[model samples]
Each structure stands twice: as C-alpha cells, then as structure tokens.
Target: MEKITHISVELRDWIVNTMKTGASPEAIANAMIKKGFDPIFAYRTLLKLVNNTPVEVLAREQQPYIYEIPEIGQKGNIIATSDRDIKVLMRVEKPFILYLENLLSEEECDELIALSKNRLKPSRVVDTATGEIKTVPGRTSSGTYYRLSETPLVATIEKRIEELTNFPIENGEGLQVLHYKVGEEYKPHFDYYPASKINENTGGQRIATVLIYLNDVPQGGETIFPKAGVSITPKKGAAAFFHYGNSKGQVDRMSLHSSIPVLKGEKWVATKWLRQSEILERS
Candidate 1:
C-alpha cells in the first residue's frame, strides 16, 4: 500500500465534479487508487465526500428522451426457439421492449443459481463517457459471468437466446448472473454506450439486452423503465428483452431502466448484452 500525507484540495474538487456528472463513488475511489492512493484510504475518502454531498449534486445526469425503437424482425405473440417456445406477454415500442414468459425452466434456473453461488462479486457499471467498468454504489448487487458455452446448460441457454433474439451468438457477451439481496438495487441507466464514449479501440455500441429472471422476489425487485413509465415484476423462469441501438449509430435514451430495490427476498437475474461488433474477450 502506498502512503499519502497530503490530500489535495484539487482532488476534492475533482471528486465533486465527477459526482455531479454521475460518476459513482466506487469509480471515484478507483480513479484515486490508479493515482497511487491506498485502496482503503481512497474508498473512505470517497465515502465521506459522498455522505457530505447534497442529493441534487450527486444525482445522475438525465438525458433527453429518445423516441426511436429498433426493429425486432420477429412478429407475433410467440418467439420460436430451437428448444422452447417463448411466449411474449407484453410489448412496448419506444424502447423496443418485450416481456417474455416461460423463457427458462425451473430446473435450468436452479442449476444456474447453484453454479453462480460461489463466484458472485459486486456488480459494475460502465462509465458513461469513458467506457470503463467501475464497481459503483448505484449497483448494489453481487454478480458473476459465465463464458459462452462454458457448460452444456449455459450453451443451451445461449443458443435459445440467439434464436429468440435473432442475434449472432458471436456478437454477444457471456452470460452475467446477478444476485440482489434485500435493499439492493441498480440505478436507472442505458444499455448502449454513449456516442461520445465510443472509440475505435472499444467494442461497438451495445445493440440489445436480454435479462432473465432466475428467481421470483416475493415483494419488490421489479425492472422499472423510467422513461416509459413501466415496471416488469421479476418472475422466475421469465425474462425481459430490449433493444437500444441501431445501424445509424443512434442510441435510445428511452431505454433507461433500473432494478428496483428488493423489499423482501433476494432477486436473481441473468443478463446478456449483444454488441454490433464482437467485443474483446469480455464485454
């Protein structure tokens, strides 16, 4: 660990500005660590600054709502897959939303939950303007990623998702399993990378998201779309799919969503992000 006798006032100002722009407490702490500050000191410093900051100043910056919805080629109440027939219970156009039922079996859900139990770690969010992954206070859940086709079970699920979404499997990231305990939640945010943040070195903008609910929360833990004024309750074996990007390089701001705080039991979900291009080893 490195020792620092001086905590510069400039550092404080930087933290304040970053927070105002929606940087997470953990992201600030991470930036400090990269600057040679001890991890513990960086974390505590950010915590104190966050605690003292006003709510309005620390709030996430809101973007103007976008009205465009990407095309989903499949038409009908049911999305056919190689192995299962997924029923589309609901649809919303603006953000290209679909509420799917019977997307996963109880056995599959249990198996996924079991496989992820020991590997879960804190979930992270991508920096809005930097494309950097940061563990953030805004996302208060533990998660783990499973490589594509890592197991026979995962392979089957990935295949099903590919068929359901009509997306190339090669362009999709690995499966991400997330577990949110009581009181934990993910703040509202977009699935696609901001245009300002895109660069040749980075993976292309995210095209869509497939979020599967592995278990039912007896109380809260709904997936809320703030822009659309819609909330989908987490149901075991069901899933929510949404598209936020298209070929013209436009990203939908209406795709802003969050995981509502779990009020009773834990919430478990699996997420798959599809990109326009093949992302590096991981997404």
Candidate 2:
C-alpha cells in the first residue's frame, strides 16, 4: 500500500497538541515518516501545522493565465462616474494598466489624506508561508484601512469606483491608504495572494488594483513595473488600474510592481483591491 499522504482531523489535532507540549517539528515529522507517511508529505504537513496555517492540499495543476479584456480595460478614453468624469491618461495592454486622471478631486484627495494620517500604523505584509500578516523589512510604509462606506467620503469614493470599474462595492476589500516618507519603499511584489491562501468567502482571488495618488511627490515615489519597463509618476488625483487575474484562475506575473523610495516630499496613496467574487464580510 502507498504511504499515508492524507492527514485526518484527529492526526492534525495530535500534531498541534504535541507541538504545544514542547516537541520539535522535526521530531514530529520523523514520527510521521516512521508511521508510514511519505517523507515529503510528512515534512510539509508538519511545517504548516506548526505555523498554525491551513495545510491546503490542492489537486489543481498550474495553468497559463488566459488574457481576456476586462470591462474596465476596454478602449474607452473616459469613465463617467456619478460625480466626476475621469480621463484615461494612458494604457498598457501587456499587463493591462489603465492609467487615469481625475479619479478623485483635489478636495477629496486632501480629505482622504487628512482622515488617514491620524490612524496610520506600521504597514504589514502577508507571510506567504503562514498566510498571516506581519511586519517585514521589504515593505516600509505606514497605512490605514476603512470599512466599505464607513464614512461619507469613503462611501462617495467607493461608489465612484464601482461606477468606474463596473464591479460592486461588495467585491472590494475596503480602501487602504498608505503613506511613504523619504527613504521608505516597498520592494517589488505582486498584489495577489498566494494561490493556496485565497479565501473564497473573502472574495476568491484578488483580480485588480486601483491605486489612487493623493499627493504630488517632488521626486521619486514612482510606481515601477520592472518587468514591463513602466514607471508611473505620482500625480494628485491620478490613479493606476491594473488587472492581473482572470476567470481562468491565472495571475499575471508581469503585474509585479513596487513603490520606489521617495527622494523628496512624502507620498500618499489609496489602494482599492478588487476580488473575483463578492467579499462575504463586506457584502
């Protein structure tokens, strides 16, 4: 018979209990191996269990991302929201970037920054291995998030975004406002979560991002897409909309981007991450 490759609930509980009782992870893996578990499977399962993250066993194989024209990426030069007319500044098809101007007004931008400044906290990134949010060296920024339509300003912005993108507010993961000071930068990274960590209830996969610039930077603070050789300057009221995922369960690697260090003035931006399905919590 093949070695045990599946972990039962009882076995998973046993591993957790043993780990809390001072048993090393290696010892647990070795025990599982001795009990006829595949060596690799034993080690992998033990690691996830120790980290307190789900040990997701995926049967799906990796497939190339199929490119499809998203509604927001269509050949439109203008998006008419209920309160504003946003002009398409530029477009890049390879990675699906639709740069826009006037996504927010001058007053709106200032208010968002004012509201977020007081609530700023050290930013955190999701640990790929454990699927937990933690502060790391790669990302150096301060940020805050607001619930969907929590305030009048946020409600107005979210509604405008819904009108522009044709995606419901329920699919948005709330609006996150980030601030970067001189020398603080977020290294190159993708916005989407790891495949195994995508929670269906929270909205399956992160499909796109609407990054709105809130303040003008004297220098640097450009959003760089290294693979695509693209750089977007920070202009107040302008935004970048990049679609990276599709219904075919594919994520575009070319959408990888980063916020380079600010050389002069501070940088402020609000990011709205969209999901493939409605986020249950927000819905």
Candidate 3:
C-alpha cells in the first residue's frame, strides 16, 4: 500500500468543520480536488487520518456487533460483521469447516449420493426477454436436492443462529438439499420480491438466506455476485449468511447475485429461506 501524507493541523480542522456540517469524506475530497489538490491524494489522506484517529474523536462512528459461533455438537466458529452499510460477508474458520464436514459421516455422504441418482431434478427458470419458461441446457448435469422440514440438522443450525445473532428462527417454511454433479449451476437472481408483488401463499418478503455447502466440488462451482464483486467457493460444511433489507426497510439493489456453473466435479448444498412472518399469517 502507498503511504499517504500526514494530515496537517489545518486540514484536520477543515475535516472537523466539514464533517460537522454533514459533509461526507467523498464530498470533502471532491471539494479539495476542485481547489487543485489531486482527488486521489485527498481521499487517501483522509482515509489514513480517519482510520488512525480514535473512534471517540469522530463525530460519528459505527460500532459493529460481533457474532461468534458457539460449540455446536463439538466445535465453535466466528464470523465477524463485514461492512456497516453492507451486510455482506460472514466467513467461517477452518476447524469449524471440518466440524461441519464431520456432521454427516462418510457413509451418510455415500447414501445421500446414491439417493441423489434417483432424485435429480431439473431447475425451472424464466426467460427475461420473451416472458417464457425455459430449462438451462447442459446446465442440468447430475444433481439432487432434498427439502428440509424439521430435521436434526435444521434444529442444530437454528440453535447456532440463536447463539450468534440472538435472533430466534421459528419453524422453517422450507428446506432443501442440493447436489450438483460436475456441471450443474443456478443462474443469478434475487430471492425476495417487493411486498406489493409477492403472492399471499408465498408469505411475507424473505428476510435472510442461509446456504450451507454439504460437499465440496473438486473444481469449478462458486457463488458469484457480479455486481458486488464477491465470489465464494463451495466449502464443505461452511455457511453463508446474507441479509437483504436495510434499516430503512428497503432491499439493496447490489444484492442481485448468482450461482456459478459447476465445471469438473460434483457439488452438494443445503439451503434455507427465512421470512418476516409465519406462513399461516401470510395465507
């Protein structure tokens, strides 16, 4: 990283005054650029100064709440909050990854794999241009998924959620086990629609999504969010948590995401969609 110039006392005073008047760092940097200082230099300088400054010194500061995974069936993990504005990443440690892999014994994995041969189903998708339903060709290789109802795995995951977020997950509306063989993939799409458009039977808008990768693919399956610049490879037993809504109750646009196409080996995963209200209430 390039070192930024030290912020002069004069510039510090300016930053304090500008911040007091509700100007963002970007705004201040733009102003400085118009005054002849290089925009990049001003932005970098401001970032270094602000990051070096104590939180108590800033007029506004966002204190992040840490969510640690407790010992569940024999292992613990930690997932730190990413950014305040964007609730993007919640990564797991390696040991926790191993623990999750162990959750399902090798025999269980083999049984699931065998069962998958008979359970493989094609994914149904819609065409945006022509308003027609279509199947993704060759994209449906060999994969199987089993829905979750009230399984022990579901209960364990729920317990972990309560420990991490202090939020209670009631009964899950639906659950699924997804298996991808060598070349299966699901394209990009958002999970929840606006409240005005959702059907009565589908219930309220989805609040969060928990995706747990069951078996790791030796090559090529990744969840990529093109717009957000995030790509996560499938890791056996690791989970990804993504929240869709903001404090203002609006869903983020950049959250539009997709699943990467599998390339060389099979992949297996479990998914759960959470809603804002009970299914009965929505009905």
Per-candidate TM equals 0.76, 0.79, 0.53
Worst-scoring 10-residue span by lDDT in model 1: 54-63
lDDT of 2: 0.84
Candidate 1 segments exceeding 4 Å error: 1-73, 130-132, 199-203, 280-283
Task: Single out the weakest 10-residue window by summed lDDT for candidate 3.
Answer: 93-102
lDDT agreement with native, every candidate: 0.78, 0.84, 0.50
Which candidate number has the best TM-score?
2
How far out, in Å, is residue 107 in model 1?
0.6
Score residue 214 of candidate 2 by CA lDDT. 98
Q: Using lDDT as the measure, which candidate wins?
A: 2
What is the Cα-based lDDT of residue 152 in candidate 2? 99
- Clashes in model 2: which pairs? none
lDDT, model 1 = 0.78
lDDT of 3: 0.50
* Displacement of the residue 124 alpha carbon in candidate 1, Å: 1.9
Provide the lDDT at 43 for model 2: 93
**Sorted on TM-score, highest at the top, how do the candidates line up?**
2, 1, 3
